[model samples]
Target: MPVAVGSYGQTQPSCFDRVKMGFMMGFAVGMAAGAMFGTFSCLRVGMRGRELMGGVGKTMLQSGGTFGTFMSIGMGIRC
Candidate 1:
């Protein structure tokens, strides 16, 4: 039998590493979308500068947490 050799002998990331990466990516994307939505919603409701900042902050936190949790759970199940 012939021996099989890897091209560069590089190992792939582990399941845990991939799950962590997915969680981080999901959180980042969720936070960005939340910030945009919060800004627009606040503007539509006539919220001013400071209020807009607060709204965006709150939305980003909530969105990040929610997405992170869901991603972790999903990845855990799959992995």
Candidate 2:
């Protein structure tokens, strides 16, 4: 299925609200999956991804605290 996208993909939105909805929905699912994978070793990429997911989950619902989370989930990960 095709995902939605706003103009330039900014969160404030521009075009596809479906993208935002999908992102949020997938993000939550990913957060759960990531956390589940991290129950063992923090040194592993899976663990790191899990931690990142948890942080992002909190940030999205709280309206803040995403600075560190953003950095963690930056352009380095490719999995």
Candidate 3:
């Protein structure tokens, strides 16, 4: 058998892996932004307690999902 070069069993990440990582990173960033906005809006509207939590949750989920979907589409095109 021929000897392998470089890092042996360690392989470079494939396009799919890179895309998936990018998508996850984008989703996290989006969620953070959404949470900040939601908190500000809730405070502005005088929302309190559970209502504030609910608003933040909704905003985060929506933003993360939207970012993930768009990233998926973009990655698909690149592959």
**Clashing residue pairs found in predicted model 3:** none
Model 3 lDDT per residue over 1-79, tens place: 4434566686556678868876887789779888998889888999899999998899898888788768766776785
Off by over 4 Å in 3: 1-9
lDDT of 2 by residue, 1-79 (tens): 3446667884443334444444555556555554554433334544366676675455444332233244334422421
- By lDDT rank, best first, the candidates go 1, 3, 2
Of candidates 2 and 1, the better by TM-score: 1
The C-alpha stretches of model 2 lying farther than 4 A from their native spots are: 1-15, 43-79
What global local distance difference test value does model 2 have?
0.45
| Model 1 global lDDT (CA atoms, 0 to 1) | 0.82
Best by lDDT: 1
Please give, for residues 42-63, the per-residue lDDT of candidate 1 as tens digits. 8899989888899889998889
Q: In order, what lDDT does every prediction score?
A: 0.82, 0.45, 0.80
Candidate 2: Cα lDDT at 15: 35
